[model samples]
Target: MRHLKGGPEPDKHMLRRELLAVRNGLTTDDVREAATGLAQHALQLPELAHARTVAAYVSVGSEPGTLALLDALRERGVRVLLPALLPDNDLDWGAYAGEGSLARIQHGGRMALFEPVGERLGPDAVTDADVVLLPGLAVDARGMRLGRGGGSYDRVLARLERAGARPTLVVLLYDAEVVERVPEEAHDRPVHAVVTPSGVRRFS
Candidate 1:
C-alpha cells in the first residue's frame, strides 16, 4: 500500500477481488466441468487415499465444486468434517453424512452456505483430521494462500497448531488461481499443496 517502499505487491484483498471476479464470470458448464475435473485430480492424492478423517468445506457459488469430492470421500469411507459458520465468524464442526444432511444457511446478507444439519462436534474437532481441505481464492508460488478475508480458516489453522495436529493442509482451486505472488501476514502459513483441475502442485 502507501507504506511500501517501491510499491505494494498485490495484496490478498486485491487478489481475492480479481480471482472472485473471474470465478463469477464463468458459465454454468464451465463450473460443472471444472468441478468434475477437480474431483478426479483430488481423489488421486495419496494424502486423501490414506486419510481416515478430513476437514473440508462445502463449495458455494462459483468456487471450485466440492460436493462431488465430498461424496466421493464419503463413498471411500473417509470421515469428513464440514464447517458451520458461527456468529463470531469462527467455525463449528460437524460430520458430513450426505447431501440430505446439509442445511442451506443464509448468513446475514452474505451468500448462503451449506452446513451439516445436525450433531455439532465443537471447534476442536478439526484436530482429528488427517487432512484439511482449505477453501481459498488463490495460492501463490511461495504457497501463501489468499483467503476470502474471513479469519475463520485462519482460526482453524491456529487451533490445529495449538493441538499439535500436523494434518496435511491442502487447498482446492481453479487452474488459474495458482499464481506467482500474493500478500502474506505474519500469521499466514503455507499450505502443503494445492489441487487444481489440471493437476496437484506441492509447495511443501
Candidate 2:
C-alpha cells in the first residue's frame, strides 16, 4: 500500500509528547468546541445519515465528541454498536440501544459500554456494519491512522476486509490532529474518510 510521509510514528514516547502538546496547546473549551464541530460534520456525512447500522467507539482520553451524535443517531432510528473488548483483547460487539440500557463490560484496560440487543458476533461482525467510526491517536491525509499501539482495530478491520465488508471506515479527529502523514505498519488498516472540525474529507 502507498504511504504518506512526515508525521512521526506514534510510539509510546511520541504519543506522550503529542498528547502533552495537545493538552498544553488546547484548553478544555477548545477541545469541546472542536469536538462539537467535528461531531456535527460527521453527522452531516451522507454515509452516516444513510447507514442503517454503524459501529462507533466510545471515546477515551482527549478524542473528539460522540455522545451527542450517538444520541442523534438513535433518535433517527439507526442501529448502533459499540466495541466490547474481550478477555483476549479481541473485539466483541453489541448493539447500543441507549445510555440507560447499556451495561459496563470490562476488557483490555478500559470498560466498554454494551447492550444485549444485537447478535454477539466476533470481529467479523464489522462486515455487516454500514459505517465504522474508528478511534485513533492521530490520522493523516492518506488515511493512515495511528492507533494507541494496540492492534485491535487494525486486526478487526483486516478481518472485515478478508470477509469482504463494505463498511465505510471513518476516523474522527480534531482539525489540528489531521496532518500530512502518519507512521504506519504493514498491518495497519486504511480508513475511507476522516472528519474534523473543519469538514469531512475523503482519503485517496
Candidate 3:
C-alpha cells in the first residue's frame, strides 16, 4: 500500500474525471441496488450503530446513494445531521427530520441540493456528532479520501480538529472506488473506514 509520504500525489483532476465517467455509466437500478447494499453494510459498523448524532449528506447525481442510510439512522432514533452549503463553501448543519423536511435550493449555478428546512444548527453543530458520513470520489488503501475538490469537507475536518473532536469519519463509495492508491495532500487526513456496496474496510 502506498502512503502519502512515499509516493507522488497523483493528478487529482484526471482522477476526478475518470471516477466521474465511471459513476456516470451507472444506471438507475444500479444506483438503487448499490444504495441498499451500502446502507446495510454501513449500518453494521459499530461506530455508526452506536452513534447518537450522525452528520451526513444527501447524495446527488450518480454518487453512492445515502438516503437509505440516512433514513435508517433516523428510524433508529439517532439524530441525523445533514449539511447546508454556505455561500463561502463552508457547511452549516441541520437535523434530518425526514424526507419531507428537506427543500430543494439552487445554489448559484450548482445543482439544486436538498437541504433541511428547519432552523440552521450553525457550523459547530458537526462537532457534536459521534460519526460523520463524508462524500468522496474515492479512497486509497491508507483511507485517504479524494473529494470533489469543493473544499467543503476540508473546512469541516479542520473545524473538528480545532475543536478537539474525534468523531468516527467514514466515507461511502462503490467497491471499485476503493483503490490501491489515491493522491494525498498535506491536509488529507486518513479516514477510519470506507463503507461500500460489497462490504466495509477499516484503517488505522
Candidate 4:
C-alpha cells in the first residue's frame, strides 16, 4: 500500500490518539444511539444479510458499539463468531450464543474486553466465516482501516489469506470516523466496506 498523505502526515500512533480522544468524549447516550443506527445500516449490507457465519467482536469503551449488530445477526439465525485474545495478541474464535455467552477479560494492563465464553475454535477458525466484521478507529477513502494498533486482527487477516479464504471484510465505525485518509503500512489490506451510523461506503 502507498503512503498517500498530502502534507506533513501523522503516523498511526498520532492518528489513533486524536481519534481516541474524540471517542472518549462521547456520552453514553451518544454511543447508544449510534449503536442502534449502526446495526440498522449494517444489516442492510447484502454481504452480511446473506452470510451464514460472521466473525465479529464486542465493542469496548467508546468504540462504535457492535452488541446490537451481534444480537441482530444471532436473531437472524446467523452463526456469529467472537474472538478470544491469545497471550500473543493473536485472536482465537468462538461462537456467540448471546449476551450471557461473553466473559470480560483484562489482557494485562489493556482495557477489559468482552470475549466469548464458549469452546475455543482456534485462530484458523476465522477462515470459515463468510463475513468478518472488524473493529477499527477509522476507515479511510481507500477502505483501509486504522485499527487500535493491537495487531490481533492483522494476524487474523494473514491467517485467512494463507488459507485462501475470501471473506467480505467490513468495519463498523461512527459517521465521523470515515476520513479522507489514514496511515497505511506495507502489510495493510483494504476492507470491502465500512458501515457507519450514517450509511455504508464501498471500495473497488
What value does the lDDT take at residue 140 in candidate 2?
74
RMSD in order of candidates: 3.9, 4.0, 2.8, 2.9
As for TM-score, the candidate ahead, 1 or 2, is 1
List, residue by residue over 97-149, the lDDT tens digit for candidate 4: 99999999998998999999889999999999999999998888889899999
State each model's CA lDDT, in order: 0.91, 0.74, 0.92, 0.90
| TM-score on alpha carbons, each prediction | 0.95, 0.83, 0.95, 0.95
- Residue-wise C-alpha lDDT for candidate 3, range 126-178, written one tens digit per residue: 99999999999989888899999999999999999999999999999988888
Candidate 2 lDDT, 47-131, residue by residue in tens: 9889999988666445677766777888889888877776666788877777765665545556444434456766666778999
Off by over 4 Å in 4: 1-8
Q: What lDDT does model 1 reach?
A: 0.91
lDDT of 1 at 38: 91
Clash pairs for candidate 4:
none
Who is ahead in TM-score, 2 or 4? 4
Model 1 misplaced stretches (Cα beyond 4 Å)? 1-8
Q: For all candidates, what are the clash counts?
A: 0, 0, 0, 0
* Highest lDDT against the true fold, candidate: 3
Looking at model 3, which ten-residue stretch has the lowest summed lDDT?
1-10
RMSD of 1: 3.9
